[model samples]
Target: MSAFGAWTTAHGLPAFSYTMDQERDPRAEWDPILEPPTRRHAVHLGNRRITLVADNYGLSGLFDEHTALRWLTRDTGVTRVGELSTDISGSERIFGPTFVIVRVADDQVSLERTVLCPEGEAPWVLIRLRVRNLLGEPARLTLTEEWAARPAQVNLISGTAPSTGPDEDVGLELELIGGARPRRTGSGRLAVPLLLAAHGERVVELRYGLLDDTAPSFEGSLAALRDRLPRASAPRAPEAEREIPWHAALLTGAACADGVLGGHTLDQGSCYSFRHGFNGAARDPLQHALPLVYIEPDLALSVLRNTCAWGSPDGDLPYALGPDKQPWTDLFRPSDQNLWALWLAAEYLSATGEEAAFREPVPYHPLHRAAPVPLGEHLRRQFRFFTDVVGRGEHGHVRMLNADWNDMAITESGVDRELMIAQGESVLNSAMAAWVLPRYAVLAERLGDLVTAAEARKLGEELRGLVAEEWNGRWFRRAYGPGAVVGDSDMWLEVQPWAILCGATPPGRAAELLRRIEATAAAGSPLGARLRWPVREHHGPGGVGTIWYAINMTLIWAAADHVPELGWQWWRRMSLAAHANAYPDVWEGTLSGPDAYLAPETDRPGRTWDLADLGIAMQAYPVANLHSHSQPLLAYLRLLGVEPFSERAGTGDGARFASRALTVGP
Candidate 1:
């Protein structure tokens, strides 16, 4: 049994086990796993198992190991997995009244199935499905099935068959042998039978193979073939996470939709750190702060520190990292660049509470005697850039304030300006540096250089002063600020409170900002977070808007620090947004033309990394953990309730502000 396993044992859920029979290769030439999802829609065409939601109302678009691989290809959004079909002879599928179908108006679906092999290995799959409901409701009811075969090396799943070779044994059958059942014979491959409530569904699952290996190097895979599914069948894993390597977060509420997600893994540690910024550029520093936000604190903090080191002797950082450790992009947004870096590092250290760890040398850029990343030099240069340079002409921040990308604001718009300075301004950077400079100064003091500590104190005070002076515009900006105010980012402040919560704003302004934020929150569209006071238009880059995914991440931090009870509020809003938006999965932007709004389409480049990071970022929420949160849920709730570092966000000085409301735009 696995450590988590225990039926008769202490720590186990009701245990049901299974074993499979030996099978002949149908064809060495044919791949087994069928269609893989181009994006994380219910559509599947790769080597992944899937499961479906019972209520069709929640997470109907989400995918799990049981979502039929065949259905994924059909371009359909189905609530439940159908029983395996018997007549897949031609292109047509088996249909029925109880089944769900994609609408004809939304004919993006084509009933299809395929066999896929993952990296040419042991676990293979075969799936058959049709998309009749993805674009809209369907004309006829239809469902697909998939057969997935995997040969796992570790068998991390307890109560599952041990890793005996495929040739060595036929599949193992788990029997609900004795005890209570009126005498009856359950035959064929052995298994557990779960009685479903009328019109209700339950997750049927099994994890096999962990009984054997412990090494990461172990190689084993699944092999599968499509058979007309069994009687009254459930579905495949129906979840995308079963196939993609992801960490998940969780949310719980009755009104909540089926899928909830916190974030996705962009790099190993970063979550939501843009893989590429404006003009498709990416920053390496985010890997430490964003990716590792919820997973590994020590490693994440290390990434943040190293990123800070990249600040040049003149105090600039490489725009992005190349494969060769060279800077990739040249355009840097000081708001996103410096401030985010500082916040992330301090966030990590604050999270761990192991101040002692701060004394050590960070990775890649260091020599124990004297690391070259001299803070004094870099800080001075950065100070000059923000206070002195950057710009003031036609496209300057002071001029454009609400402008898109680097153009600044000319158009009146929504939730981005206070957001801009709050993210970039001197105070945020100072606040972050405040934490570090002092620590480093303390280290210097301990090392007998009290003078450095004194200097550090000055820097800290300066940074704090900057915060009080700027980075404060409350509520969701109705537009940009005073001098450089863009008529567009009409100054309201839904996003302003986050600045206060994140420490970009001064503590005194928090209550006012919080109150403004609460009033600005949109209540009508479950999916749309109002861009401003009146809530007229949508706000975002890819055109789809940023509220849905962005809020999932930020809210978790909200719950993590000030209010765990608020998690339900976050989930309700996001869940409703997903449905109000009605996307099979998220889109790069909202759709206005001939296509479905950013919903996943065949061969489309997707926001995979974002989804992964959402899961990681959710760790602050204290609702779900790394293992429990996955798509479509975790992507929507980056603040998984339970996490590795709840110690900080959950009960720190920040906790004092939980009940307080923040008013930013006064």
Candidate 2:
């Protein structure tokens, strides 16, 4: 049995726990057995930001962009019956919504250490150590805490940066409460002595404050801050699937913050290679907020508005927003960024039924300084940009500016990037636009915008027709460019399911394509579907022998209606439990996983995969809280038939779009 399963059964607590007792391969340079399993949670209040990471051992690090500090060593000294000893037993970790509890127990005493980063602008993380004397006789104990400051780069590129910086002097303020006065043992070390009666218990609290310009001084007691911490509720699911949504919310919630470029924005991810805090992606927040629409509608709406605010006056959206909210205009030049706005707007409206929100005025990008326009106008501008500015190619498909949803699609060998950008067309984006544009038109018509509604429907129909023409009798061609047609011989998993989901494929053809996908993409994998069959030898990232959560989740969404059993099966295969089971010794895949997983065919099966040209050796990024979490949660909801965009808006069927509100337990 897995450590989590054993822990849950032993404690009978409705919490998720993972123990690090599994043996790993000795040859692996990064040993999961010795390395601590870490979880990083972000606390953002106004402009101040602090990220705290607690591992199974204890509180590991507290950091921001400019500061990083962690406990170097924790030693416990216990004297019982006039005998002094210095030894500690192994530890077990339990993960709560906003905190982690690391418990260490022995014959003499039981020590439970809880680390919490409370929400709001407080610049401190609270550490509570509860000690209970297990012996019948009185016990004298001393706890020594040692801390050191590491280079800030250690935390900065905790995401995907190539290297770290030199160690620098960073200051940390430690305030202790309810313990004997700490004696200075050595530089960056303190020893606290405590006397306990027979079978007595005592609690010690430490507030580690960050010394940064953005961080504000603590105004209340640590207990008060703990009391004020927001309580989160997890959505109800079957016992087997319950933890999925809970952990999804926990990770995605850590990526979100207020007082960003746009109010209530979400970052791409929170830790490891995914750590791009303060940097926002236009497509990521939309996908991240999809599941949130059912859990937290108001927050989801705010995210939608925030994403809309990232649009320029010319209706062009940035691939990403940097720390200062500056647009990274030329980053990959993805053509599908603007289309996501329309897709999300449709989902938001269907889920909330808030027609009036479309009329609310929202400012354009701060770079433009343009007058605020209605939310509906922002979406219309996006539609206009695609239909008028970008326009269709000779084949009537939408223009692929550098790339589409597959950022690396145009980067394959022998393909001229410039030529592809100038004339390439994305069938995937065309299919997506075909699916979303009509739905958006339905919304536009409901808002009494007849012209836009008609225009959207027309373009959607034209794109659908163009996409259908690219069908290669087996699966739809991936894209049209200077190089050989992508996915012509080998089926590209990304676009095939989309064609079915968007209703572009005929009913019979959709079923045929799905069956083919199951036989090729789905059948070849032990954990979820593969990106393509007979893996591409000279392909870019995501081309072959990889499974991206975002793309496969779409497969689940599409299969839910047609292949119900396959949908659930594929969903389970992509789940955290499945990854944990497949790679019990890999810490990154045990608790959380990367955005994409390398298939069994790859050199490092069950590990993370990205940047195919860089080789698999360089792309095994550690697990980070990413939109991968949100995609599975959203797909699960879809599998449960909780679709927000099922009903066609403004269709003469007289059926109003309806949505079921889902709430997490508190």
Candidate 3:
């Protein structure tokens, strides 16, 4: 076993251990767009995203809107131990929730490098290198580090014209402590001298990050930052299951704290290859903050407040917030945006029991100079938007204006999108509203708003009946449209779980639907469940026969509500261990993966960024830090019997463990 394996075993966590001597790919090339280095781990804090490759190479650069301004690559930081001539060899790497450890050793000396980006308001990365002497007699050692810093810009989005921005000076800055004064050997190079007693250990600390105006100053000591680094508090579960929450924390934490958006706002993720590091989605921040309510309630509350601030006076939310902190609303009109805000506000209040939050005044979008309103008023506007602005269809289901949760649902070929947007109805959104409104009504009643509470309960009951009418004997239909009904013949996995969760399906019928889902959708892929069964081709990305992490997470939640054993089984199937075992060649699958996975039948099995019909073979959007990370964290909590809404409604206890141990069943 490697050092990482030993550490994981000692700590009761699963190990994704690698020995570089055998696993390192010597032929791997470096290209940010087409063939970037595989097996990479990134750390994020405040406004910076730093990546380190598997073979101890660093992708050192300053992040911009579309790509990175490179200061150095490949040999970003090369360190030599002993005699200043001996090379460091025999490397091993291990990944933790928020950190990565790399160990290299020679016959006379050993070095362990721990890299971390602590959680705080500063944008910086810390590298602590500990070197130990193995000789019986006192040894003289010299440490030399070198890097070639040449500033150049690389465009990650292929075939598009490069974006021009303001000219700014950006480079890598380094500060070293606990060693002799560093001597500048050459350009972008520093050498530190050290002497150690026999079998003695010495520590060298390197604080290096981007030096730009966007980065804030750090007044605290390096030791203070290191001490505040986020550590994983293991949940009570099987040894293999403990790593799920740890991975969830790392991915969620990595996507948070984009100071440009808001102090507590979360970006999509730090996956530069995917071009999602800097933007914020209206619905994503609410989902991403769900896990934080348990770990950090104050930060979670701040996220709720910041997300609510993006609402307009008419209660419409922008599709997404750009890197410039501007709203993008010209693309599509999504009807499900406000629904998420209402749902999250209720969840936050239920989990924390912070009734005082309702009275806190929050401003509208900065573009609108309207007076601030109480948080409760913001939530009420969201509810009214659904009831008035985006009114119901003829069938009493929520209007699908352009699209709903499935962005690609009404975007198929040969369909008049305008007509469909005007008349289409989404059963998925209806089920969600049916589930969210009544629960939110309880909170409203507690806050002494009887009128809104009564109105909410009436609307919720009406939508539930409308949803029940859409059942097609076997399962629920996805949507109602003029051209052809979706999920009419084929079963859509997204809506069925929601139907069971919201009590729209009868008890016996819900059980039958879940069993059929297990036989079809869940059986489609060995890696959890597919989005739909009886795969059909569509126009663009994420058509059919795909396993989306966000959708499947809801499946786990509903399954845990009815059948705990089956829920645990599906949860294990979607585990990182399962992904690694299935696709050993894909590096991201082992550490982290994209938001969705192509089914086994696709050309790129277990991989993302496959748009073959559009003449794009693979665009290299590999890294994902979206709801995929957050939903799993929420699902795991649900499996542990933490149902906040139910607990607050006096139906169950919040954050309590299940009556018996949950184990994987055959």
Candidate 4:
């Protein structure tokens, strides 16, 4: 790209887009119109109609601020803007009823409220207009009072209590334990005939103190007395002269960490990809996968444990799992999910020393990083699901089922096991075997269970041998599905040859995969290529690629560990390749492309967890070598190293170069 293009990339500015709705509508059903400036012109509100814009994007739907992915990753630093400031009462508990904050990148919103009568000295509640423009257009759109909230709050689900079924009045995720009749504050929406547009922000806000409390239930202490959280402050470039380095570091870290999670989870995980053609936006797991990696180690371990528990006595993670918990195969494939998550888990465990954290239990609360106490047995079982059952490799060669990351639905019936393997293509289960066996071996030995340790090592060796034998030498097969065999070299498959089973791949094959990756045939990208074959299958709306930042990071790390000589080059290549998500929280995957779409998990019912693990991908950057893969990596790569990446190249080097450019007191 050009210097201007490079600048646009580093700063989260859009490079190119189809400006008109007509051009946009033909391709995607649910195209993500992220910039308030770009989409506001297309939206119109009818009387009494509030079409939630954020809901379409995997958020939890509590206030505009609540998101599905972040809920699970709550403990991680990636979170809502409201979290950064005080609520109305100046307390964490009290937040606005009118609007809610999502990621910190969304620091402010432009609220449109109609000034009301009885406007005394206090005039009910003081309206705060929060403006945020994702387009990098330098200005806040100020919406005069058009609506207000007595106790402002975006509509969000509360508590995971048993649902009495879907009711229009109550949120599915939220629960009002005791008699809780939320007050009626006559909160109104801003009139729409007067459609106004800021260069970049859509007017959204919250309200409070405009009316009297209608109900005495649900404890005012928990609801009314909680101090209001301060609104997320807008960072003015001029005023932020000193904070640039800090913010830049944080923003870059968020992006790199998320890159490690490429193609991991099925829910929101499916939404990540880098295909720039037809299947450009095909849903996969990587998007939020890695962010979750860094944010919560225990959570990542739980996911691994689940994968391990699923191993069919013979060892194989299944194709996929329905939100309802049914097994799915034939749709999306989990080739990398099981393995990647497992490797990430083991690697994370080693770094964080979160064994005690894992003993705590399941339901794998994405929101909380370290559970206070051990989780119950039932929860543990859930965690062990992937570790213990799904694929046993029973009838055939420790075969695996063919299901994509989401594993929710692919419409398969009377399915048996598949027996196809290809090189440069470390299938999901195989990847799992490589990542888990070593750790399990160490763990089993520590517990003094000789048999268990032996079995673990046996499993690891068995997988390593199988991968070397099955992979078609150059590339790996897509799946062990019906008759079709996708034999092509994919970049994602490149990592296992190195990162897994203590580098089981032979020197020649390892070099081949690295070369393919560097050449961009396997993992091509303006930023980075995706492992997606049949780019013809690029998913959803637009004509964008499936590249995900998290996946790129994983490949780079694996290369650093295995290829060594070539690792730094790929490292430099990838370091300059991340121009996707503009939320300050890395690209969920190349965002500008028409392909980016919501993952199946985001479409699932009830509350959901965001992919905070992706936030940790950056932790591996500055390693002198691959001494520590998780925390220590994070410390050196993201926080410790000199500039953390491409140290020899120095500052002001490339377009994507995340320059600290500052000296901080912290």
TM-score: which candidate is best?
3
Best of the two (1, 2) by TM-score: 2
lDDT of 3 by residue, 137-169 (tens): 788888765544444343332433133343333
At residue 633, give the lDDT of candidate 1: 33
**Candidate 4: residue 543 lDDT (0-100):** 12
Weakest ten-residue segment in model 1 by summed lDDT: 249-258
Q: Which 10 residues in a row give candidate 4 its minimum summed lDDT?
A: 40-49
For lDDT, candidate 1 versus 2, the one ahead is: 2
Question: RMSD, model 1, all Cα superposed?
Answer: 17.3
Model 3 clashing residue pairs (backbone): none
TM-score of each: 0.42, 0.80, 0.82, 0.46
lDDT of 4 at 105: 36
Superposition error at 506 for model 4 (Å) = 3.3
lDDT per residue (tens digit) for residues 428-461 in model 2: 8989889889889988997899999999998888
The candidates, ranked best first by lDDT, are 3, 2, 4, 1
Q: Assess the local accuracy of residue 205 in candidate 1 as a C-alpha lDDT between 0 and 100.
A: 22
- Model 1 TM-score is 0.42
